[model samples]
Target: MIDLLLQYGLFLAKTLTVVVAIALLMMAAVRARRGMGGSDDGDRLEILDLNERYKSLEQALKESCLSKKAYRAYVKAERKRRKARDKAQTEERQRLFVIDFNGDLRATEVAALRVLVTTILLDRRDGDQVLVRIENAGGTVHEHGLAASQLARLRAKGIHLTVAVDKVAASGGYLMACVADRIVAAPFAVIGSIGVLAELPNFHRLLERHGVDFELHTAGEYKRTLTLFGENTDAAREKLKGQLEDTHGLFKDFIREYRPALDLERVATGEYWHGSQAVALGLIDAIQTSDDLLLTASETTDLLQLKYSAHKKPIERLLASLQSAVAGRLAAWVGR
Candidate 1:
């Protein structure tokens, strides 16, 4: 009974925190909407040097909860050697511009993507390379297409573009990845799903059962072929199917234009493959993880991670707060 009460109390606290976070966000959004958002910094750019990240890694290693015998021995020697060499080499001959793309179903990161790429184009010069670490399970067609086009801009500048997939890149994700000069993925990371897909629930029958009527008007005959509340005709369904086919064809053409080595007919069948399998199908150029790629780049080049700093909106702050709270609670629960 005591434990149950404690759990309930914790749950209530978390719920209240989330509610407060959301309320603050709503207030902030309303103020911004009314042009009264004083001091709300729009987005800003944040650049993190990969070599400097080792400081955090060293701290984390020291705080490891796992058995640290073999790991400590190896990392200790490497760290000492790296420290000795760091003083001698203040700069590298080649520089790698790293961008991270963590996408959602709507390709929400496309705005950041555009900003980062444009900045690189303006500032980067010869002997520089762009490495995009992308983790996306694909998203809306036009949105991801725009994201891929943003990547294409780097390629157009004769920049050596390398895409590193750490987790998964399918559908629209693969669309963007294929635009790179090289695609690298982990041994078991998901790579390809070069197919277009769209789905929406239709409520026409439910509306009919409820005796509710819905009428939609459009300028063209095909303006709104299939709708959520309207009865879909056979023609409407066929038209949607035809549109999907056309989109798929363009997807294939785009990939072929960029990655001519890939066998489009086989890989573009809406089937996803792991890194090794993708490499075998010529969908991915190499089988390696993004972490390894970053470490390698740090050795041969100055690795700089690019991020667009934007003044966090109310919702963004709220989300970050919620994430931090949840992580803290989870860590406590795990005794970590």
Candidate 2:
């Protein structure tokens, strides 16, 4: 009889556990449905009302009709209200997209920029601005040039575009920076290296020492201008120099067309200047960091920094922490 009672108790416990598991699963499903759900019509109506209010406030502020103190107070209150409304209406409105490029100019960076620009073109409302925080030391001509052209498309669509350079923007990087409606640079950011360069090491002597030979072939007269193997001729050197000169001329022309106020001859001397010096040369308009610009713009327009990062999941974070702890223990053991 006791054995039978024990069996019954085990069965009851299992039944209860299964019931609890099912209940938890149902709760999770309900929450997931809510998170993935679309905004209701009522929410849309609320957003439209808030937008109308924002427009009214903007118009009032523009006409200089309010006293200074009143204007400040109104703006402060309005911004607070708008922020709350936006947070509540997150399901109804689109988010501001920010593209951050902080590395070498490569295909991945270009592709990211392309997608960003395309998104802005599709999602940006009228009067919205696209901010590009660019930090590049420059790279291949064609690569960076393509990136700049992508930014130019924003301007073509009547969208406002601003580029903030926090570090060096030299050579091809400057090409990208020129397309912005306004360029803001950090106080000591490196700006303007309007030049092109090509370098090759001739291995003729090194190969001779090793008693090795290399063959060369060419279909066109200037197919291989500064080569690493064959003897370099005056003709080849001159040809390469001419190509560099042509590229430089194109770079100068592009800058002049975009920033016509700049004295191209004076500033395009393959010289890099600090941010303040760049302002004097008309390379950049203002010496302000992106943080300052964003803060100031927030007072006038809605300021946002958008990023697409592959954040670590909870399990991944836990594993990483565990691995770090193990490594630390191993190092301590070695020190002992």
Candidate 3:
């Protein structure tokens, strides 16, 4: 029976090996096909006309819900409005360029944000505004700082910028939002967390118990502090604490610079508040959702939603499909 089990295990391993080889060969063929396709337009900026989209929705609703007479009257008025709008083409209409940022721990969306900002800077006319519908629970310091700086570029160019938060924008996320000219958020959206923190578990005791030695060498006095695999000395702890305090101080200073009216002592306690509470704390200017703001603006102004999507290669597509399939299978197994 043990021998039979071993044979079955070997057969399974061989089957897996064959499957992997076939996948690799198929991926190579796809890569070759892509190489021959030429001219990858992966960095293209996609723009959606929110005005036309809203109009289409409104027209559809009216057609379905309104009386025939009301529908005809609405169509007539829309035609006249369209004619007048076309005739007044000489007068430049104000545009609200909308973008979205869904951030993770690394603020990976910054890559696409930079591209969108560059494109807008090139094509934007005077009186045009930008509305960033941002959703991020914060991440690393340098990455979020870079994202904020990108928004600052718009401010430098004298462009009006508004950041709208529907869910949460804590710590590093707030860092980016505070750079906007105006920040609007939903009533219950989370805001603030103006502080810094660094913590890690040390495995020195565990290693020592296992009779294993972990060595770390450094030249500078404070080269490494509160390491993962080494004993944390009091000096190292103090150094790390001092560094965190310094980072928190810098964060407070940054917030104060953008929002002079905010009392740093009160809000910079690494605590977050809902959007309505944030208004009282002066963390956000107003409590309004992005959808409402954009819809209202679309009445007289042209609202354009801009998105930058990277072109995926054939291998990426295949990998993504495989990942989805594996995830689905795991989910089903867990449910069962």
Clashes of 3: 0
Q: Sort by TM-score, best first: what order?
A: 3, 1, 2
lDDT of 1 by residue, 1-336 (tens): 999999999999999999999999999887887696455556688888887796578667665853678667767877888798877876656889999887666676788889999998888778999999887777689999999999999999899999998778888888999999999999877777778776899999999999999999899988887899999899999999999999999999999999887778788898888888888899888998888888877767878888896667789868756654553343233222
Model 1 clash tally, residue pairs: 7
What TM-score do all the candidates reach, one by one? 0.74, 0.65, 0.82
Candidate with more favorable, higher lDDT: 1 or 2: 1
Root mean square deviation (Cα) for candidate 3? 7.6
Q: Scored by CA lDDT, what does every candidate get?
A: 0.83, 0.74, 0.87
RMSD of each: 10.7, 13.2, 7.6
**lDDT, candidate 3, 1-336, per-residue tens:** 999999999999999999999999988887887899854456677999999999999999999999999999999999998998899889888999999997766676798899999999998798989999988777689989899999989999999999999987888889999998899999988888888888687899999999999999999988888889998899988999999999898888888888999998999998888899999999999999999998899878989999998777899667756654553453233223
Candidate achieving higher TM-score, 1 or 2? 1
Candidate with maximal TM-score: 3
Winning candidate number (lDDT): 3
Q: What C-alpha lDDT does candidate 2 achieve relative to the native structure? A: 0.74
Query: What is the clash count of model 2?
Result: 0
Q: Candidate 1 clashing pairs? A: 42-311, 43-309, 43-310, 43-311, 44-309, 44-310, 45-309
